[model samples]
Structure formats: structure tokens, C-alpha cells
Target chain A: MIAILSGGVGAARFALGMRQIIDPTEISIISNVGDDEVLHGLHISPDIDTVTYTLGNAINPDTGWGLKNETWHAMDALTDYGGITWFRLGDRDLATHLFRTQLLSEGKTLTQVTDRIRKRWKVQPRILPVTDDELRTVLYSVIDGRAQQLTFQEYFVRYAHKPAVSRVIYEHSAEARMTPSVIQALENAEAIVIAPSNPILSIGPILAVPGVSEILSRRRERVVAISPIVAGQAVKGPAAKLMAELGLRQSAYGVAEYYKDIISAIVIDDTDAGLADQIRLLGIKTFPTNTLMTSPETSKNLASAALSMISGEPV
Target chain B: MIAILSGGVGAARFALGMRQIIDPTEISIISNVGDDEVLHGLHISPDIDTVTYTLGNAINPDTGWGLKNETWHAMDALTDYGGITWFRLGDRDLATHLFRTQLLSEGKTLTQVTDRIRKRWKVQPRILPVTDDELRTVLYSVIDGRAQQLTFQEYFVRYAHKPAVSRVIYEHSAEARMTPSVIQALENAEAIVIAPSNPILSIGPILAVPGVSEILSRRRERVVAISPIVAGQAVKGPAAKLMAELGLRQSAYGVAEYYKDIISAIVIDDTDAGLADQIRLLGIKTFPTNTLMTSPETSKNLASAALSMISGEPV
Candidate 1:
């Protein structure tokens, strides 16, 4: 079994690429859950839905999120009622939340709901939430010159992640235990691949789970990470800005340092060749290649490289 | 002031005609609530939405319900999750339910939500539900040689109102009180009109509220009703089938008898002009004209005749 740690768009895209190189049936994706929130009384898990939609070939290629040919009729009507429309819920996407909310209210766990959704999408990989319990990412941002804590959506959607964030913390991560399937997937994996997602915002919360980081630390030799921040900038989203604001290195070297304790090798872009020595000095192997996944071939090649790196194949 | 005791489609269409003769702002429609039901955890008041959408010019003319140019993406997706898709919910229409559900959860009454929704639609008619409390229409039907009780939607939508209904009852009608607006609108009205909706299915529930029938009975001289039946046939819906099943008068004369106690006059169609003298024998005046609202002119003419009948104008 091949286990993958994933977030939203980047993670989903990477998994799509990885599918090109391996049997999707052999993959178990442990998706981030810190971005989950209840909107309009409907339970929404952004990461899980993104991965599920992406793998099922239902994702909107334009936005890299939501469903293809989706309509925003509900949202357009919502604006007339003075409802918050920042998060951008599409017409078709509302079904996932409605089904999930109904099932969860009927005493089904989030895990069961996720399974039902994936089954409907016919997604091949086993998509497991990091935890079924409540765990959220809260950011302390300076708004109107006063530091106030905001939920992940508020920071990311409402404020457009423009406000200066003083700190980022995970809520309930300390007490939340990883799901049994996730633990088993980790234990039985031939290799664990960390997807090229936002290291701090996306991947950080997964590591904060009580036993997740420890498990990866123990199996460090088989853990490989693809750096999202390449050439000091993220290919998409706010990784570089967030890292710079959080007072961390904004280069591939910074990404390697973030996962150094729990990873055997770090894949940097060809542009980040100058940072190889620095990452190597931190006691982690570096794989330099054309990591910019502009096409399916690149992403699949990246997946092949991860596999080769795990099997001790020559670079 | 003109007060209309209303239900769905027929009532909304009647109100549209009435608007052609009078200022919409001067009209107050007290709608039936016995058909209201919760589906997918969303509070849906079909009658209220119909009247609201109709007056706002946003209604689908072909279907006689829902918004114009609406998308069914949410509902189509819902079918994949094994949800009940028989009660079609369009994408834009889901916003109304979502807003209503959220506002109701936040302690806003159904009246408040209705006002908010109408205001957004820019509807001028003061559409008020008969009561804010829980009230539903339940039908007893014989299916597969067994007597079964079903909600109004099940009888109307799921079964296409096909099952032989033995009886119809209203839930919580005795305990439910009319909203303050409805009571005040009724007490101060110059004329009260029972729209040409399904009398047993629509107008029956409105009058079923504990004090509503008594209030109108006391003001019997000022009240007028339009017959849904004309020449032993209903203009639309299951009214004809239901009236026949319930063993009520299946003609305009029968309609006159149904409202004989509280209404001063009943408007029948030109086709049913032969039954006027027989209706007058029941101590009610009969206004026979072209009541087939096939065009805006016919609906407007019917509305004008109803107004003239109230004022002793030449019929």
C-alpha cells in the first residue's frame, strides 16, 4: 500500500498525477481536516471533497476546485438574502454537504460519510479524513490594528488571507486521535509520500495529530516529500506569503527543514539547485528535477521519481 | 383592503390576475400552511414560495412553480447519494430553503423568514402564512389493499396523488393560531376572497385553523369565493379527483354549497352558468363569467368581476 498525506488543490492534483504512475487501488490518501467547517448548517470538508472530486474526474479544471459545469444559482440567490457568499459554494457541490450533514445528524461519523461520498464518486483511492473528530485551524490575524483569532475559512476566504497573521494553531489536535484506518495505512505502506501542498497551512495540521508525526518519524527512511515552495514561490496559493509572514525560510530549503525529521528525501525543483547543499547538510537526501507539474506527464514523472527514490533506484 | 385566503399554484396565479386590477401593495394573502413539510432538514413552505415567486416575476411560467431559468444541479447530484429526488429542488430554489432553515435555526419565525424572502424577491403582495406553528396535511390512502397514512407531499408528489385517499386531515390545526398579521388583515378587510385553488386540499386547511372559519362566518356578508370547479371539472390540479373521492359536490353548484355558510357569493365559469339558479337556492349569489384564466386578460377580467360583485356592479 502506498500512503499519501494530502491537503486540497495541490494535494488533489498531485494524487491525480500519482495515479498515472501507479495503481490507484493501492493508494490510501490521508486528507487534512483542519479546513472543515459548518456552513449554512451543512458540514463541509474542503480537503476530502477536493481530493474526492479531483480523483473522480468531476473537479472543475478552471478553478481546480468544485465540480465540472457547476452552477452558482443557490449562491446568487443567497446574496439577495444577505448571506455570506465568500466561500463560493457551487450548485452541484451543495449535494455533498447536504448528504454529509444528513448522515452525520443521523449518528454516522465523518469517516462513514466520507466513504459514502467517495463511493458515489467512484473514486478508486481510499480517502480517509485525518480524524473523524473536531479539529480546526485557527489563525490570529491583526485586523483593524487588533489581533483577533479567526477560523480557517475567515482567514482564507473572508479576509482573502490578506491580514497579517500573528500565529497559527490547530484546535483539538492535541486530544484527537488518528483514525484506525489511517494508522494501519501508515504501518503497512511501502512508501509514504507528502504531497506538494502548503507546508504550514495544509500539511502542518496533519502532523499535529497526536500519533501521526510520531509514526512518520519512526518510519522516516521510507518517507519522501515534494516541496511546494520552489524557487522561493508557490506554484499556486499562499505558501510563500504565509511562510514569509510566519518568519520561516520561503525556499525549497525551508520546505525540507519543515519535514526533515519525518522524511528520507525532499524533491526540489530544477530552479532550486543552489539549495541542495543546505538541505543535504540537514541530514536529508535531495532529489532535484523538473518538479513544476504543468502537465500530467510531469506529475506522473514526479510520482515515478518518488517510487524510485523509495526503492533505492539511481537518480 | 383585499384579503385572499390562498394556497399554491392556483392561488398565486389568481393573485397575479388580481394585481392587474388593483395595486399589489393593497393585497394581503393569508396562505395555507397544512402542506408545509421539511425535506433534507430544510424548511419549505411551497405555497409561500409560489406566491412570492409568482408576484416577483421570477416564476417559471411553464411549470407554474419554482424560479425562472433555474438549474437543478443540486437535485441531480442529490440523486447520486440515494436521496429522495421526487420532490424536485432546483439550485436557485435551494437558497430559499437554506436561508429559511438558517434564519429559523437562529430563532426567526416563519413569518419573519417569509418577509425576508419576499423583500428580496421585491414582491409587493403582503403574503402571510395562516399560522406559524406546525401544521401539515395528512392523507389516508389504500395502497396494495392496505390503509396507509401519508404526508401531503407523499400523496401529491411521490404517489402523484394516485392512491385512493379515504380521508384527509390537518395536523395541529386545532391548536395553531393565526399569525397576528393574518388576524389583523382579516379583521380590517373590506373583502375576503377564497382563490380558485383546491378547496378541500388548499382553502380547507386555511379555514381549519380554530378561529379562522368563525371569524369569516361572522363577516359572511363581505366574503366571496371563486369556484375551482366549473361544469363538474376543476381548472387544474387534483381538486376534481379529490372532491369526487371525498363525495363532495363536483360542480359549481356543489362549490356554492361548500362555502354557503361563510361566503356571500361564488364565482363560477360561463360553462357552469346553467347552475346559477340552483346555487342561488343555497342562499348564495352566483357570478358566472369566463373563469378559465387562460390569458392575463381572462384572469384580469375574473379579478374585475370579483371586485364588481363585491361592490354590487352590473354582472
Candidate 2:
């Protein structure tokens, strides 16, 4: 079985491509929980939901998040009731949150709740949260001349990621250990693929989980990473902005360096070919190709390329 | 303030009539909370919502509950996800639950959360829950020749009120005292009205709150009840059937007897006129008229008659 480390939209799209190369049932996704939050008293795991919706063919193509054909009656009603509604929860999407919240309140772990959602969606990919315990990314940012700390949702959704983030702290990650299932998936995987996601916000928290770094370190030679950065920019989201703000390089070389200790190979975009030698200097094998996953066919090609890099087809 | 004891649809309809006679701002409704239940991990107070939505003119006139122009996207989606969708929660109605749940989770009392919902609806009536504490009405029923207990929502919504109920339990009602506002409204009311709600299921729970019965007893002379049953038939809901199952007389005289000590007068329907003398024998004055609240005019007339029966003008 192949294992993947994931964030939200970018990772979900990459997973879609990967599933095309291998059977969806053969893939296990370890999703970031730092962006998980409680909104309107409902537990929302954005990253896990993204992966589920994408795999289930229910995701809204325009937003790359939430469900398609979603209605906003609930949010509109909540808005009229003077409820805080900066985080837009579609009516169709709310069912997932409500069910998740119900299961969590009934003392089920996030992993169990996620499994229920995945099965309901008829998604074959095994999506597991990196940590079952609460682990949130808190962003310290300056918005409208006011310096404040905001939850990942508040920073990402409420402000539309407009504020200049000074720092990001992953709460509870240090104390949160990998779930047994996730640990087993990592241990049994023939190859590991780190999806092209926001490094600091998405993959950072997943790596920060206690013992996750050590596990990846042991399986370093079998791991590969696809750069979220293409040239000097992110194909989607605020990955480049957040990486630059957090005092990290916002290029393919930077991505390779970040995953250097955990990955033996890195897939850089065709535009970042000049950075191949630099990425190789980090003691990582560089594969320069059209990494921009815009269409299903192109994404499948990219997935195949990444898969072939693994020894013995990593079946 | 004119205080009214309420249940759900029937009581809301009666209150709709009362508001036509008196300014809605002058009315205080002490709604029963025994029907309250947590569905999908969201707190749902059906009685309180009915009153709030009806008074706010946001209620779907056809359903007698939920908001006008509401959508069922969330419930539909929840159904697709295999979550329980028996208690149909409309999309617009979900906002109330979400907001209430959030406030309650934030350590706010149900009263405070209810006030927020009321104000957001721009409703002028003082809608107060009988008690802020948990008071759920559980039904012990024999469905399909099997004996089992269920929540009020399950018995009502899930079972469609079809089960033969052996008993009705008001959980935690004995420990629940009236909220301060409800107590004050009761103490200062010109007239206390018992809306034409189900006696065994609706008004029964309100009367079960620890100190509420005593307060009504102290003001017995000014207490007036509008019989939900007219000519041994309920205008709405399972009042008649439940009363018969629970061993109470399913007639207006039964209603007068039900409130004998706390209510000095009762407004029965013209159809129940033949039972007036029997009701009078129960030490209660009877006001027989066209008490079927088929129209706003009839309901207002009924309200006016009940207001006039308060010993003094008590307007």
C-alpha cells in the first residue's frame, strides 16, 4: 500500500491523480489536523473533508473545498441570527460537520468519525487524521494594523489570508502521537508521497506530530515529495506567501530542502528546472517535469512519474 | 405582562391569536422544555422555536414549525451520509440550533441562548423557557408489539406519534425551577393563560417544573385555560390520544379537572358546551364559545374572552 501525507485542496487534487495511477483502495492518506476547528459548535476537519469530497467526486470544482451543489440556507439563517459566520459552511457540507460533531461528542476519535464519512461518501482511499487529539495551527498576524493571534480558520477563511502572518504555532502537535492505524500505514507502506501542499501550514503540523518525524526519517530512502511551489509561486492557495513569511524559501529548492531528511526524491515543476542542481545539493534526487496538476490526465501522468520513482513499483 | 404557558404548534397558534389582541411586546410566553432534545449533537427546543418563529413571522405556516422559505439541504445531505434524519431540521432552522449549541457550549444558560435567538428574529414577545435546566419528556411506548422508551422527538417525529404510549416521563423536571424572568412574569401578569396546547404532553411538562405549579396556584383566581380539546377531539397533535392512554378523560371537563386548583376559569369550545355543568362541578367557571381557532379573528376572540374571565379586567 502507498501512503501519502496531505493537507487540503492541493493534496486532495494530488490524491485524485495518485488514485488514477493506483487503486484508490491501495492508498492511505495521513491528513493535517492543525487546520481542524470547532465552528458553530460543529467540528470541521477541512483537510480530511477535502480529501473525502475530492475522492468521492462531490467537491465543488470552483472552490476546491466543500461539496458541490451546496446550499447556503443555514449560513444565511445563522447570519441573520447574528452568529459569527466568517467561515462559510455550505448546507450540504454541514451534514459532515454535524455527524462528525455528534460522533466526537459520543466519544469517538476523529479517525473513527473520518472513516464513517469516507464510507458514507463511498470513497475508497483510507484517509486518516495525523493526530486524533486536538492539534490546531494558531497564526500570529497583523491585520489592519492590529497584531493578533488567530486560529488557522480565522486566519485563512475569516481574513481570506490577507493579513501578514508573523508566526504560526501548532498547538498540541508536540503532545499528539500518531494513531495506531496511521503508524501501521506508515510502517507497511512500500512508498510514501508527500503531496504538493502548503509546507508550513499543512505538512508542518503533520511532521510536528510526536514520533511522525522519526518514522519518516527511518523510511527516508523510500519517500518522495512533489513541490507545492512552481517556480517562485504556489499553483493554488497562500503556500508561497506563508512560506516566505515564515522565513523559508518559496521555490522548488526550498521544498526539497524542507523534505530533505525525509525524502529520497523530489519532483520539481518544469519551470523550476534551473533549481534542480540546487535541490540535488540537498542530497535529494530531482525529477524535473510538468508538475502543474491542472487536468485529470496531466495529474495522472505526474502521479505515474512519482510512482515509477519508487523501487519495485512499491506495490 | 400577559404570561402564557405554551407547548408547540397549538400553543404557538393560540399565541398568534393573542398577539393580535395584545401587543406582542406585552406578552410573556413560558415555553415547555421537556420536548427539548439533542439531535445530531445540536440542542433543539421545539416548543421554544415554535413560539419564537411564530411570533417573529418567520415560521412556515404550513409546517407550524421551522422557518418560512426554509430548505432541507442539510438533512438531505445528512441522510446521504447515513446520519439520522428522522427529526427533520430545515436548513434555516439549523442556524437556531447551531447558535444555541455554541452559546450553551460557551457556558451560557439556555435562557441566554434563547434570548439571543428571540432578538435575532426581531420577535417582541418575551419568550422564556420554563427552566434553564435539562427537562426531557421521554415516552415509554409499545410499537409493533414491542415495549421500548423513546425521546419525545423520537416518539413524535420519528414514530409520527403512532406508538401507544404507556407513560410520559419528564426527566429532570422535578429538579428544574422556573427561570427568574418566567417567575417575574408569572408574579406580575395581569392574567395567566394556558394555551390550547396538548395537556398530557405540552402543558403537562410546564406544570411539572418544580415551582411553576405553586406560582399558578397562588394566582388561581386570575388563571385561565383555553381547552385544547373541543368536543373530545384535539385540534392538533396527540393530546386527545395521549390523554386517553395516560388515563385522563379526553374531554374539556378533563382539561378543567386537569387544572382544577390552579385555574379558576377555562374557555372550552361551543362543541363542548354540554360538558360545562360537569366542568363547573369541578370548581371551575366555564366560558363556552367558538373556541376552534380556525382563523385569527376566532383566536383573538377566544383570547379576549379568556382575558375577560380573569376576575378583574387584568388587561
Q: Score the docking of each candidate (DockQ).
A: 0.50, 0.69
lDDT of 1: 0.87
Best by lDDT: 2
lDDT per residue for candidate 1 within A145-176, as digits (tens), equals 88799888888888988887778999999988
Residue A157 lDDT, candidate 2, scale 0-100? 89
Tens-digit lDDT string for candidate 2 (B49-76): 9999987888898888888888899998
**lDDT (Cα, tens digit) per residue for candidate 1, span B61-169:** 9998889998898988999888768888899999998899888888888899899999999988898989988888999999888889888888888898888777899
Real contacts retained, model 2: 0.75
Query: A156 in model 2: Cα distance from truth in Å?
Result: 0.6
Pairs that collide, model 2: none
Task: Classify candidate 1 by CAPRI docking class.
Answer: medium
The estimated TM-scores of all candidates read 0.85, 0.95
Q: Pairs clashing in candidate 1?
A: none
Name the lDDT of candidate 2.
Answer: 0.89
Q: With candidate 2 superimposed using the best TM-score fit, by how many Å does residue A293's alpha carbon deviate from the native?
A: 0.9
